[model samples]
Target: MGRLGVPPLPNHALATRLADAYRAGTTVVLAAGDVPESLDAAEAIQDAWMASLGTSHAYKLGATIPAVREALNLPRSFYAPVPDDRLFRDGAAVPMAIARQTGVECEYAFRLARDLLPGPDALGEDEIAAAFDAILPAIEIPGTRYGRLAEYGGAALVADAGALGALVVGEPVTGLDPRALGAAPVRLSVDGTTVAEGSGAVMDGGAFGPIHAFVNRARARGRTLRAGEVVVTGSCTGYEVVARGPTIAAHFEALGRSVSLRFAP
Candidate 1:
């Protein structure tokens, strides 16, 4: 749905259009591909885009403590695929794998809205607040973009062919208090049983700092950070690799909301 039907635009072009639409106070979302061929292309595209955008890259957490990391035995690196915009508009399934080295865990963070905020960059708090008015509750689907820690460094890993995962836009979290909103406990359940837990504290003690930093990094590049853009600062907790054939739910405790997801083989 971009550029007057020009082959639906390449993944990179589609991503730019999604950001542009968000800046224009319009919402846009897309789907993601799990196929290795498509995954490789998507990751390549995102690495180039992030580099061009100069956005800061970081992983989400499942919880706030080291104890959780010990429990999951997460690896330092992960595999990720570039997601379509629709997934951002609606909740989507995310697949992840644990690494044998680095022992780093990964988690998913739900960030809605297409608005951007002010930071050391040009926009100020009041301006940002005003722009955020049209924000929506878009979900951020994060997974292992990179294969493993031994495979590459964080930046390199993300730049690699397999580092980007699906990014979708889902239901808009209404009445999200930008000022009052910060980090808190986030929970996830599978078949009514808790499978993952995380906290907002992982995002630089709260959502503001890290989210701002992320946007600022993006702004540093050629792209302009607009208002009404919602971004999930990063994972409050690390990654939680789920098993096959199960129903999953992610809850943002601080906000008192939850999203249900169905996974496919």
Candidate 2:
């Protein structure tokens, strides 16, 4: 490949690369592009095509809803988190006000316990705020940029919502303690070497805020947050890519087990 500035490959070629990756069950991270100024129809073409596959979306950007809109074809589709989906976990969500960029680094995100907004039935503001308080945690990861200093924001709110699929991790906790919840230590390894280590506590304001925001957005669009939805808050640690044979593993210490995923060409 030429320099990053070189013209992008033809759409067919790009689609082939994405399709192959998806078929292999390997995760492919894409930068949700900035819009109007950087809005390339070709990029959206690729994104739309990818949604047909099993790829998932992440809202890493924190505050930039418009940018997220441009990156993901939101107005064109509705987003609801379902089982077997994944995104970047363990890192903080980026705000929407800045102009920063990051390369496609691989990361694994956690899914929320329920679908934020389901169907076309939306809710009022008061109802939404209470929902936010109900789902989010209180800890934060304290940072704005990733390893490459790319300005990340809440990408979930802006990306193609239908692309998400949550993995069925046993069952949801019902009578669990919320106030005294401790950060679960999760060990992440790349290529068999521990590159990043983090915990559930790494998420800012716990996981509820994002859920609330997501639900509110959906409700605004006349959607309802349904049960059994998946929401990956952010990355505990920034993304780390694997060029050759890298195997990524994550062990949620609280779960007393580990899961491994690999990147392949």
Cα deviation at 77, candidate 2, in Å, is 18
The global Cα lDDT (0 to 1) of model 2 is 0.36
lDDT of 2 by residue, 141-218 (tens): 122122222223223222222222222122223334322234666566665777666654543344333444555444
Q: Whole-model lDDT for model 1 versus the true structure?
A: 0.39
Per-model TM-score versus the true fold: 0.55, 0.44
lDDT, residue 33, candidate 2:
43
Winner by TM-score:
1
Please, what are the lDDT tens digits per residue for candidate 1 over residues 130-238?
4444222223433332334213333233333222333433344555655455555666667889766666555444544444334444443334443333444444445
Count of clashes, each model: 62, 49
Determine which window of 10 residues in candidate 2 has minimal summed lDDT.
Answer: 96-105
